[model samples]
Target: RGMNAYERLTSYWPSYDSISPEARRAYLQWLSSGRKAPHANIGYVFLFFYGLERRVFVDAKTDQAAAGDIPIIIAEVERLLSIYGKNNSFNNYASRFVDFLRQGQILARRYQKAPPAPLPYGYEMPVELRIGLGQLAADKQPMPADWALAWVLSDHNVGKRTPVTRCKEAFAQLFCMRYEERYGAGMVLPQNKTRLRLQYNTASAGLPPQELDGLSGIPDVTATSAARKKLQQLVDECTVQLEPYSRYLGRNPDTPDALEGLLQLPVNLWPPTARTALAELKQRIGDGMVVMSFGELAGRLQSAGSLSREKVLTLARALESLHIGIEPDVLTGSRTPKSEDNVALFATQADDGDLRSSPAYSAASVTLDLACAVAAADGDTSPQEIMLLSQHIDSWSHLSGAHRKRLKAHLRLQLNQPPTLQSLKMKLEPLAEPAKRVVAAFLAHLAQVDGEVSPAEVKLLERVYKTLQLDPQSLYSDLHVASSGSSVGSSQTTPSIPGASPSKPVGGFALDQERIAQLQRETEQVSALLAQVFVDDKPAEPDDVVVEETVEDTSSICGLDADHSAFLRVLVSRTEWSHDELEAVASDMELMLDGALEQINDMAFEHFDMPVTEGEDPFEVNPDIMDKLPL
Candidate 1:
């Protein structure tokens, strides 16, 4: 009555209480007597339970036991298990062990998916990766190392594309965009994607298009008030000269070959002696080779027309710079057909001793010369302008050593090319239509040198525009909006060139103190911004600098020898010193101080050589305190 159902299950004698006295005695007998009765199913279950309960053997104890002994041991375990039944047997142990192993596996998977902590909020991420080893080995010059970093951020595959093709595409896009940014979109005449693809294909094949009308345009680089004023002046001057020339030519009605008056003007002016010298040189060197010589070339032009030696020399320099095959010889024989044809485009002679004009000229040289003249007129040259000029010069068709030398000399002298048809046409080209406008705008400022554009200067401008493969009028817009302070082909808002002074005029104009100060502030801000972008901005050290200094001991000390100090100095100087010049010097002093401290320690410690008794130890407390104390 006192024990409930739970208590009955917990109690050990539940069977003895419920069953008959005989059954209870039998259960007690079964527990006390361990007997082996071999039945196949019982024996199998008992042996399986025994094997399941076996501990992992560390030694060879189980291997030597008899086979019959194993069955007997299993039977004895089963007899004990029969009393306990299924509840307290091998099943409980197996279930608990399985549960523990399964729980561990679950934990291993859960920890694997957790995200790492984000970097601190203020830290800047590095933008560039190290260039590949292959690229470094193959590189001939120090390529702009920063270019790769800038490139990756602005133009790389975000997801699907490969890095190489993406880089190339990005670069192409940037090149075109840069042009549009500096010049107007109209300047390039960019069409639809299909048209651009076709154009790109044609360019790739080296097959240039037939003559098209260029979009007349000015660049954002010329957005300043000074630049506008200069451009207006150029337009006015060119209009004055060209308007008259176009009228005159329209009235004359002369055939291309039969301009009798024109022929006589140049022929009568030729110097026979120089012409003869040129003819001899041309014969000896062949027209191809003689065309490269400036002296011979100048004489050839004199033979063609009434050019002064100086004017002839100027033309010769321009022509040779273009790499055209022409000689001043009057003789017609031995001139190969190819040479004859090439010279015909640059020819100024009809039959003999006559000025015959051709359609071609050195457009690039003339344009550069005009720009240089404008820059010189500015009074103070800027680094931006100088860099642009350098880039412009680099784009020209490569010339020979002698020709380049002469051309540079001419530029240095600030000499103008004459206003002949050939010289004028040489100032223009189809591919560089926007460049022509740049040159023309600059030419306006050039007249500022003397205060006005002359008839000769106007004529030079007209001839240059006329020579371009594309029609120049198409590119230079007729819209002259004086109030808007802009023209048709120019951008409404002009962007300044990088590293250029935005406040200063793009055209050659003087700035006041206020403007100069503004430019300085802007430049400083830009420098700071650039510093933030760069990873390593340290100034390079001089290659031949002494990074370390040796300090000699010239002091008298207690028992320290001169040789020991000298040895210490050598040891200090020999250690690697990697720091700025000032810091390195300080570091060397600290190292020398450290050595002196060590020397002092040695003199007090090991060098003193104090004798010690066998039983004595320095750190032990004295046990003779009782002896020292008063009794």
Candidate 2:
């Protein structure tokens, strides 16, 4: 419809008295002769639209061209302006005007060659447009027509508040081009970055011009106070809704890097809030610190309420990369050691001065928990995997004084091997059962983030359960018991109800006779057994306290049907101990590591001992023990 109107105005406007003779003749001849209707009039209209629409509509009588005739009038204006400069005026003003026309023509031609694809009706302009125009306007000389058009669009008087939107978009396209130039067409932003970009573009909105300036000029002190308040409020909100995903992925490693990468790409391209956070974080981490632990930074990002969840994760990734390691000389004023362990320790030292409570520990714990939570959400319980995850926890924890020195020395060693169960058990197995449970609980908490359990996670849980001598199945089943109990207790503690009969239970009987009796009879027995097996003797055998449903022979017993994968994932991610280290851990509680090893070996041996009389897929056989096996 707009195009149709424009065409009608372009074809009819030659008859108007405001048009020049030369332009009128050109238009009439083009129209009467009908030589494909030369687009010169259309071009004129475009220029006029660009100029007149840029200013305020001060009055109805103002020289604002009708919307339909804007383009044609602009082209006519350009042509006449050129003529006036070349023939009528010769003084300094004329010279300057000539220069302006030339520039405007170049910009217009460039625009014509590729006028920005028309923006959606309510779309904001990209950042590139603003910065590009700003750069162009920086010149002392008068701007050309196109540059002037850009300048006017960016001007404070332009009623629209989103000039930056255009600038942002423009900058993004420009950055994309620049990125492609450096990294090649096939290279793409990291997944986190891509996700964040999509999210930022979608959720972001522009303010009115006045509001925008207000936000932009938000004083640091004011911004800081607001950010801190927001952060506190958000943290409180998170306390209740903090599901496994929120706990694990809240300050996830994957998020913050994507955001940081975007911020680092170009300052002028980022949103004001994003720019401010990035700038502050950069200052905190130091300009040279590109690669960092997302978990570490996020922990220190106490004033992170200003950041979106996605942005927080993006920043995490940026800090985790080795390429962005902090410069030792700048931070701690020292170079690192040569050994892998030493290097790791040195890296910690280089981060900050404090050892017991450095930002590095905060980062490591958060990221590790996030990783574990992500794994557990999958819900595959396997012991072997848990053992592997434990090693990471052990390796990461206890980074004070001598421990810190030990880790730095080992930092130089290759960490390329995929974490394994034997390795985790090796380091974590030596810790006392209570200590192991603490570490295991930490891992479990992390795994619970996603609300599912993996085979590796099961293994970690099994090790902890066995060491503590608690029933793994019962524990898993009652996993939500802790949270549920807390909720109920809170409700029961309330003194009164808003609109209830006084005689009836206000908040459902402050837990007196019936409920206590039922719980005592049902749960007490199990709890006592658990206390005997886990808390007292710390017995390793399932048969000692765990009730068997079937089977009689104690020696030729079938293996415990519990999953161990969860334990394994947690174990491996936490530490890096050797097999002997694990064996020692089992030994502390009188659980013979050698016996467990033998059982695992026997389980493997039992698999191949079966007869295959008929032709079949050998691998199709199930490895579980048969129901009526010889005892």
Candidate 3:
């Protein structure tokens, strides 16, 4: 469609408001699309024009336009305000319109001119009227009857007014009128005994003059005999609807009985509607009953079978508006305050650190257990060990006092039944590879916690290395660099063992003379045995024997256990080992394998019919038998 006249005018002037009748009609038709505008800016434009319409009404009232323009302005203002009343931004503009109209009435009264007739009631009139009349009554002026009746008829006032107040004014007016028609006006009670008299007296003290004016001429009655049951039912329903707010109001002391006090607070700082609803409730239910009802509702909502998400959210929001702190878990139906404290007892390190789901709690638990095991391995748990463990526990700030105590106690118990290497490895196996490396590093740290690593601690660390399938050489190097007070992973020389003089370097590592000599003697012995076995044999290819079979056969021949045999096999298979190093391992096993090698040598010589000669070797075996042998 082509651009409307209003759209064209706005495009050029931006703030243009003085449009012709046709343009104004086009604008109104455009706004009638509600939220379906082609662009969001159109909605803003609609609000602007709507505001201008309200300004027109103000001008008409100012001029005291009695007939033609006044009615038209009122109808247009009502239509615009009703369409956008729920919008906070629109309400802000409408409030100004209401203020202007109220000010005009005050000026008319001041000049002794007759006040204009009250504006006709429309859908958005009640809240706007209530606010306007409230301000007028605050100045001690009597509010008009038509204005107050319009407020009472507005069903949107449910949470804004107390059941008792509503019953007296709105319900009483309806019931009294009915009764007067059925039983005649003379049958009505004396003025002082009538419900209307009581309501007017109470309202006159608290309500604006406009609200009181609306109650002026209703027939007074002491009781509505036939309508009592229905009136009571309406009162009960209103009380039930107001129950949540009433309870909230009774809990605070600053503004106990009045809902208006809450409404007067800054809109951004408080839940205005909720607090007002609560205050209205407190007025009808009395302080004690409201408090009791709130407790009952809270209890029911907390229970498993009775809990409702909607009710819980409403109650929580209400309490929050009052600045009352509530645990979110309670609203989520997860745990009560007491239960939450109890749950802290079993919290893992991740739980204590406020890391809800990143690190697995099970992994943390296993890590803790391994640390305790390492600490206990040294016969006695020292103060340094305890302090280190305490430091680790302290990092988990989410742990409760009871939880920390229990963990410490469990660590003490673990010292009595210290976990075996295999058991510790089982725990560590489930951890990720990085976690395993970290655990290994921590164990190394624990061993050197007392300034020096004891032989037993070093031995235990070696066992851990084997059990966890970690590199012992790398771990040893790391621990040594750490103990030497050098930067880790740096190319620093290895520090000499405590009380041992620095000796000659073997493959760049310094070794004690005595240890070097022992190694040399073992190497010689291993080479001599290998010479006897392979002396008369054809050179066997490295690929002739399977490494797996060689390892198993070597274990059986040397009478060693499977684990030790595997260890030895791994050392032999490593390409990094020097010839002397390989000889040393073979030499270490020579004593146990002596008889087995001798029997094999004898059988091979017999089967081959090879005779011993003076110049030839007597211990030489057949090449085939030597090839099949694992030695």
Best by lDDT: 3
Clashes of 3: 9
Global lDDT for candidate 1?
A: 0.29
Which tens-of-lDDT digit does each residue in 217-263 have in candidate 3?
33222121222233333434544444333443444435432332222
Instruction: Return the candidate ranking by TM-score, descending.
Output: 3, 2, 1
lDDT value for candidate 3?
0.38
**Estimated TM-score for each candidate:** 0.17, 0.21, 0.24
**Root-mean-square deviation per candidate:** 38.4, 34.3, 44.5
- Tens-digit lDDT string for candidate 2 (528-625): 22223222221122221222222222212234221111111111211133455444333432345455444434554575454211112211222122
Deviation from native of the Cα of residue 186 in model 3, angstroms: 44
Off by over 4 Å in 2: 1-11, 14-311, 321-467, 470-631
> Sorted by lDDT, highest first, which candidate order results?
3, 2, 1
